[model samples]
Target: MSNSAYRWMVAVPAFVVVAAFGVYLGTTHGAPTALDRSVMDTVTGLRTPTLTSVIKDVTVIFSPVAVTIWTALLAAVLVWRDRSLVRALPVVATVAAAGIVGEAIKLAVSRPRPPAIDQLGAVEATYSYPSGHVMGTTALVAAAVSVCAASVGARVAAGCLAAATVVVCAATRLYLGAHWVTDVLAAICVGVGVALVVPVVLAAVIGRLAPHLPAWVGVPAANAGSKA
Candidate 1:
């Protein structure tokens, strides 16, 4: 199948699952499932000061201020790599858009952040049906790997590293009782879906217009022209 088709396929199913998961969590916010409580017990049970501190740091990487700083840093890297703001928009957009979607889900669900009795870390003001930290990390890492990596091998390596980051971010949320297990799971799905869909859609649109558009509008051309 064509790459664009494959991306659309992944995007649609992934978003559907995320949506359904959100609805489930939203409708059931008042009631906790056996699995949910069990997992919470297990994660909360295993928490320690050292691990908690480490996970808190990991979770902070996706916090508003941290994400902003990280986005700026990533943009700088992309600019250094491709030297074109036009070419970097979709990559940056992937992360930003995922964050927006995650926030929207939180608003829509209005699920309370984990109760303090369950929390090892400070309870955030934001709702917690889907973990934005996981979403942002997933999108940020995927966006970076997709847009910044120079070769198949490099992309593969980046993907592995990004996946590890996502896992750590998600685990930290669970460890701190900041989110339910499925919240992190859905974030993973949404983040990955958005990351894949954004680049493919952007590339397809740009490739079609590459001939008619200004000389500075092509990603691959920009990529070829600049690398650091």
Candidate 2:
């Protein structure tokens, strides 16, 4: 199959699943599902002072501020290395768009965090149908992997690393009771969708504009920075 076709195959189902799931959660009026409660129960049951402290530290590492700073640094490094703004646009755009999309869905769903009893790290005051932390990390890692993984073995390794990073971010949210199980899952879906769509769309736009632009932009073609 064509690359674009494969991307759509993966991205479309993700968006559709998240949309339906979001609607279901929205209508619940912040009530946790049986599965949500079950998972939270398990997570809360496993909590210890040491583990909680460790997870709280992990929370700080994946906080919105930290994620944004690291994402910006990554984009800057990529742009500097490639000497092409187009090369790093996908990572930056994917992460930014994921944050926006995740926030919007959170607001629309208006789901509350798990009960105070389950909250271990810090209290969050925002709607919580989707964990923005997971979304941001997921998008950042996925976009970076797409840009950097060129060989089959490299792509496989990068894919595993991206998955592990996303899982850790999601786990931090759950372990701290910052989000219900669905929230992190939905964030992953949304993040993946944004990561998948943004690069191709950006590449197409840059490809169309490449001829009109000056040579200094370093975008010579649609696939300049991206690997096939």
Candidate 3:
């Protein structure tokens, strides 16, 4: 099979594995147990007062805004201006698709949040299996790393920053009692699955289309900075 076909094949299996694992976790551990609660609490407790306060206050801050602005800018620069859309589109599209998939999985799973903490205000709705925040952020970071991979030093820096951000975001969710550990893990799987599939698919499309685009449009966009 061709590379594009191979990517699609891999995506199908990876998505299935993530979805199945999410289902198992949701069904077997629908509710957070005492142990789950204790672990979350311990992690929350370990945060310094300043850090905890910042996390509590800014847990959801800038995520939606950052994703929106970055995606738009990247798409416009790569697609419309530089014709490198093939390089940039996958990252934006992957992050957006992952957000949608994460929400869908949460709806299907319908797991509840931890019952032991008052760190975060209660969420009235059901379906808390996979955290949208974690999944979405992971997708964004992965995309950032891919887009900046031309430079080895930049790639290394991006990777470190991305890893740190994911850790902090996941920890913040648990610290604020917004999601369970299993939920975060499921999000990670879903995010990874999406990250792996998007670029290869887009690269294949780009290979076919790049030859026809304007010369000026094929230039690579400058790396402004890491978004993670």
Candidate 4:
């Protein structure tokens, strides 16, 4: 099999494993238990005045606005370096696809958020099988990493940043009582699966368009320094 074929083969099994694991967790842990309550309370307790205020501010501040800003920044870098538009296309497309997929999965699962009547009061009525915040940030970070993967340092930094982003986003979701731990985990799996596929697809597109573009166009190193 070719490299692309190998990638797809790996991705398919990986996605299946993630989905199956998510289903297993969802079914086996249908409802929040005392342990869940204890854990949630612990997280909540750690939400000191400063931390709580920061979380609230950061969560609200980093909404779609931050996404847009980052996206534009990435695009600007590509455009500034006169890279092929094809190379930058995937960044936007993957993020959008992830959002849509996240919503669809949430609807299909139809898992309700943790009961508001319990310790952490509910805030929204949407299905919570997968967390949108986690999915969104995951997609963004993944796209950024893909665009910067040509260099060893870039790859390492991207991996670290992506991991940290996922953790922080997942923690924020749970602390805010917007989702159950299981839901966030499911979202991470789903987001990761999508993130893995998107860059490969974009790479193929860029490869095909490479001949038609200038020598500098689509050079991965050229855009490596740009924030994703």
Query: How do the predictions measure up, each by TM-score?
Result: 0.87, 0.93, 0.75, 0.76
Q: What would the per-residue lDDT of candidate 1 be over residues 1-228, giving only the tens digit for each residue?
A: 776677788889988988886778667763556777889988877888998888777777776567667888877776665556654677677888888888888788787766788987555667876788788888887877766677778878877998998888888788888887878888899898988787776666777877887665554321222244
Against the true structure, candidate 2 reaches a TM-score of: 0.93
**Model 4 misplaced regions, further than 4 Å:** 1-6, 21-30, 33-38, 61-65, 117-122, 203-228
User: Residue 124, candidate 4: how far off, in angstroms?
Assistant: 1.9
The 10-residue segment of model 1 with minimum total lDDT is: 219-228
The clash tally of candidate 1 reads: 0
Encode model 4's per-residue lDDT on 1-228: one tens digit a residue: 664566567567756765675576468554665666676777767766677667766665335557667777877776665445544666776777788887877665566777674223336777776778887777778777766566778789779988997898788778877777767776777777776677677666667777897765563321333444
Q: Name the lDDT value of residue 134 in candidate 1.
A: 83
Query: How would you encode candidate 2's per-residue C-alpha lDDT over 134-196 as one tens digit per residue?
Result: 888888888888777778788789889989988888888998888999888888899888888
User: Is 3 or 4 the stronger prediction by TM-score?
Assistant: 4
lDDT measured at residue 227 in model 4 versus the true structure, 0 to 100: 43
What's model 4's lDDT at 131?
78
Query: On a 0 to 100 scale, what is the lDDT of residue 143 in model 2?
Result: 84
How much RMSD separates candidate 1 from the native structure? 2.9
Clashes in predicted model 3: 2
Candidates 2 and 4 compared by TM-score, better number:
2
